[model samples]
Target: MLIERPEANAGTTGREREMKDIIIVGGGYVGLSVAVAVKKAAPHLEIELMEAAPEHVWQKDERASAIIAAAINMLKTLELWDDIKDDAQPINDMIVTDSKTGEPVKPVFLTFADRAATNEPFAYMIPNVSMVRALRQKADELGITIRHGAAVTAFENNGGHAKITLAGGEEIATRLVVACDGVRSRLRYMAGIKTVKFDYGQSGIVTTVAHERPHNGRAEEHFLPAGPFAILPLKGNRSSLVWTERTDDAKRLVESDDMVFEVELERRFGHHLGKLELAGGRRAFPLGLTLSRAFIAPRLALAGDAAHGIHPISGQGLNLGFKDVAALAETIVEADRMGLDIGAMDTLERYQSWRRFDTVRMGMTTDVLNRLFSNDIGPLRVARDFGLGVVDRMPGLKRYFIEEAAGRTMHDKPKLLAGEPL
Candidate 1:
């Protein structure tokens, strides 16, 4: 059945009279993925995407994300991997160490050879701009309407359909509204979804560095007193850094002069990569764990950061969003194919159930890890290091950890995440 948009002041007597099938708020990776995934599977559904930022804003993002294998599979299914592959750097192995900031010798307590059995990288470091560019292109090809600078200010879930008012007083009605605005999503609040949030009192300073030597596709996580400092490999001799520190110290470092910043950075970064030069701009992001109390409310569904925002210590924040994309897209598409209301409470519950546990589990896991490792307690450090060493020696256990991190061992994954058409 073809659904048409109703004119202003149009009265809808039934759910079938909705103005649009779905209206997605926010045009980030998650929002675009939801639109592309649903439309490709169910072409009859009418979807419109709105971004509050100006056009081409995504192009200015210099950050990169660690995309796990399952998400890479989804991108392949969406026909986006081809455009994103060249810019992506694979992680063949990773090592973790718990040590002081200026330790002369940082013993690696745990090491993971991710590709020993699978013969494939567990994750890839993808530039944010590259990923968004490909998604926008795919959205365009799918004929999905994307509007920038269109901020939605008010939202109401009518019994028949949801009505949203933009900043300019323009109203649009749809059967479903998907919120991907961000961790601080206004849409989620508008839908009355509360979140369980915790501030870690830490911040991650992100920047790219050009090293004198190649990384050999190995990533490292050094657990310092302040927090985890992750060295994620990228294409060429450049690597991205997520240096965690106290909020006050993080702000100071970013604002510090280049000489002082690099001096402090080298103390934690080590000389393994030889001399390092700042290859990209630096910025600091406060670290926190935010889990939405509910994923759905009537005609509203929250995905990505809107639903759950976890600490970046594990690098699973964005991957979790991709998981939501897979699950929610599958739910909506499958419900529509069965001739059921896609925005119906029961239909949306399936998505919630599928994603809620995983989101909460990850949220708690990161919170615990950040609290445990981001300290200098002698006994605690010794106990955690002992645990890491034990896990490192057990080949089977290490393999399990690698597979889990790669997102290949999880059960009940959606078809899209398994590289199949939805």
Candidate 2:
């Protein structure tokens, strides 16, 4: 039962709400996924989600993300995959190449196909708006209370619970709080969690374009001197482009006239896709790597970007967040079943231990890759290209990499990622 403050109806002071079993901060994919996973596992728990943005803002997001096979299974377990499945575009094959921005001939050096044991594609490209819509619908159906425009201004962890203050001056008490806020998380700073961060001096240009020819469910990654330019397949004859460039050049291109922007895009996109037209607005994001020093402190836990933010070289940012969701949900549910205080540091430590190593590994891998490929050193380029070519010819090694990318190597994976109920 909700504990209502006696002065709740008065407009004089901020209203105070009863203690919640769990409070999740941020309304992004990680926050929503954790809420759904927890509710499905233990319906008795009172869960509340707080978002800074208004409800309609989520629908305005136009970017798309790569949902790896494991994350696809997690959504399916939550009964959300089917709702967005029709709009999801499977990536049947991938080709990697190394070339300059204006190179006329970009030869493929590495190729991978979807040949997993389940016979499903290794990943699917889904628009961010559609994924958020489906997750919101599911959360609502599960009786999860989501409060938009309710940003947490400050929070203090008492011995038993956390007292949280909202931006609007309201107060809330919860047994635990999970931070799923993006890279620059205010709550994380409030909790005194330090981060290891560095800017890459590059930015990624994200946009969608329609071409005269179809992509045929294929994805391509061109490692240019600046960074990796990815062409991920979308439905119909459209493809999502993630073009990278030095920060200064990226800013100029995004602010330039439409014709100039298109000309620059075409130089990197090549003419293989026939003619191209801008299908949506374009935006550029600064590239960086950020990893929190601690994933948990007292009654608080950090998930997603709040805990770790890595380079997008491999397109695994969102997938890593989903991995956090699975691990944290499982840790909490299991602890609750054992009659332990879910917010206790001991219980939270399990989650930290489970996810920290994997997160660090991915972060380092992406860092090395970004540094290795985002340059035009003649000797280094030749050596890396030769390595890629060698891997392409080794079918066994290729399959192993495909499985790893699909998240099928985790023997201790959470139930949700394994296509089972929480």
| Regions of model 1 farther than 4 Å from truth | 1-18
What local lDDT score does residue 47 receive in model 1, on the 0 to 100 scale?
98
Q: After superposition, how far is residue 254 of candidate 1 from its true place, in Å?
A: 0.9
Work out the TM-score per prediction: 0.96, 0.96
Per residue, candidate 1 scores C-alpha lDDT tens digits across 85-122 of 99999998899999999897899999986583568898
Q: Which regions of candidate 2 deviate over 4 angstroms?
A: 1-15
Question: How large is the C-alpha RMSD of every model relative to the true structure?
Answer: 2.6, 3.3
Give the per-residue lDDT digits (tens) of candidate 2, residues 283-357: 999999999989999989999999988888899999999999999999999888877888889999999999998
- Who wins the lDDT comparison? 1
Residue 104 CA error for candidate 2 (Å)? 1.4
Cα displacement (Å) at residue 201, model 1:
0.6
Clashing pairs in 2: none
